[model samples]
Target: MVRLPTVVIIGAGNLAYHLALNIHQSQVKLLQVYNRSRRGLSKIKKNTGVETSSSLNKLNRGADIYIIAVSDDAIRETASAITHLISKDAIIAHTSGSVSIDVLNNLRAELCYGAFYPLQSFKKERDIDLRKVPIFLSSHQPKTLKQLSVVAREISDKVVIIPDEERSKLHIPAVYVNNFVNHMYTIASDYCTKENLQIDHLYPLMKETLERIFDNNKPQDMQTGPAIRGDKATIRNHKKLLKDHPDQLPLYHYLTKAITRYYDENN
Candidate 1:
């Protein structure tokens, strides 16, 4: 039988919110929540009937694990404040994809410190069905890894052990897929507004783009559009229109040129 560890969560943002709810439904016992915001405290308290406080000293004692789910910048600072409160043997983990496991290294948690990154975008208003998301987990100690795996498995069916180095690599592509893609959408929205075109018209293509990837393993192989086909006339026409939108023109030209160069060099 897998032994479920007693856990405390140390944040109140979207990740922390859904994590607390997910852990509550698992075999692990949720001890308490610690956060700096009154609203964050009240939010989790309302959801799980769990005790919450802004003071680090007030953090629940005797817990087997602590998940620090604060923003990336505040993670180390928050971990510093609560290291003394937790049991020396208690596992300390964070849920960041970009930040490394070494951020918690200075606290001297050693074998007790690691990462529990969930590779999915979070929105507070949306309900999280963890079973559908991939969880990239890592730990410094073998026992700690086992304990965390059980907790993670209960929440996500797609849980996998990812080394810190590989997790870092995965984060690079993640930024392109989530952040950079969203910026592209914002640009498209701006262009639509200027052209008096309905942004809603792009919804089907946007949805299809995502659906294609979910149904395949390699997205680059599924690439489409004029640049891929070397349609010079269409490219020239697009660049002509781009002359009026200097900012977007540069970005569009840069991306299209890079893609064209890549195709020429490889294909």
Candidate 2:
């Protein structure tokens, strides 16, 4: 972006942590990091060897790009506060999947606003493998789009230019595949504990399920097990077992109905 543009990140959470590391390693010149807390600022400063400040007013002046990797709810507020501190020509961006690019439209510099969304789960303690993850980029201005794309491609080999509307849809599927699936795992873990069963028993199935779909083709095409076999007895027993847990009952029935419907049509 702008031939190794000087960048500043305004957040100290998981997304910010990994993004700063990726940017620094790519020789993109991270000018500084901003956080309201001393502890968060210290962590980012220590990890990246980059300048950090707890005060937004003390931020480094005249950066080429300002990456606001803050929380979704605080995006607009933070952007508004920081916009006054940076140069008018400085391009501002946020790393959010769900927030539209127009969230920053009210800024004095509309042409310098954009979105840089990384499609993957992030944890504060865990280091993200940025090389494999795909980064989606969109900007209101064509020149800003080109600049952000160059910056994104430096840290990720799989960078795609997605339209704002399409990117919003992508976020929903991402929640289903990543966030919802992880919650399902947590539920399974609780079930395993209650039944004196090991969660390890499902590890192979879980891993293989993902590999098969990605390595092969559609999941509907690779259908198998009791549902595909039309084992009504097993299905009935599952619903019966889930009756005591009313919360899970609906999910069980919905998935079963979906599978049964698929088999009914495909067969």
Candidate 3:
């Protein structure tokens, strides 16, 4: 039988919450979780039955891996605080897409440091099957990379070793597709609510749009509506309708012109 590495997680936010649950379910032994506040540790401890701590000084020292799943801003500070607590031979990694592995570079002389970024949007309320989520791992040391890969594979089926420069580039497109696109949906839903229109009616259309993209269809090739078709009258009418919504008008106009210009140059 293969020995799975012991794991310790830091943070109890959305990504951390989901990661803790997945690790608890996997073959890896999740020894404990650490959060800055006591309240944040309650749900994870209750569900996973793993030991929890509000202080970094109380983190489990025996775990083979320590995953710092805190916010991008706090990753460095969190790592620095736990530097003296964990075993020197243990592997420490951060769960961030945009933040580089260098955030933990300060600890390289004494310990193995790397990144364990999960390229998926996490929401604590929503339970997602992480087996399909792509996990990106990176480490300066070959031995550390191998160890990180083993832990990543146990939690996710799709694991890739993406270095810092390349991984940072991927984050740009990720934000556009996930975060920016979600904001567009939020704006549309708000508009529907204000107009007394049932947003649920658009569910099928929204589902189909995503399905088409995932089905090996290019987004630009699948483009429809007045913007791509160059229907000037319809675009004018949409702008007019959005006149009351001053904030939304600029976005509509800008997207329309962008789509129009893009197709004109390409086609």
lDDT of each: 0.86, 0.86, 0.89
TM-score against truth, every candidate: 0.92, 0.92, 0.96
Cα displacement (angstroms), candidate 2, residue 151, comes to 1.7
Candidate 2 per-residue lDDT, tens place, 1-267, comes to 246778888899889889988898896888888876775777777777999888877988778888999889999998888888778888889999999989999778354989999999998788888989999998868888887887888899999989987888899989999899999898888777876889998999998989988887788787787777889999899888777678788887787788888889877
- Report the Cα RMSD per candidate: 1.9, 2.0, 1.3
Cα RMSD, model 3: 1.3
The weakest ten consecutive residues by lDDT in model 3 span 102-111
Query: What's the residue-level lDDT of 1 in candidate 2?
Result: 28
After superposing candidate 1, which stretches have Cα over 4 Å from the reference?
A: 1-3, 109-111
lDDT of 1 at 217: 49
Residue 10 shift from truth in candidate 2, angstroms:
1.0
Clashes of each: 0, 0, 0
Q: Best-fitting candidate, measured by lDDT?
A: 3
Instruction: Name the lDDT value of residue 135 in candidate 2.
Output: 94
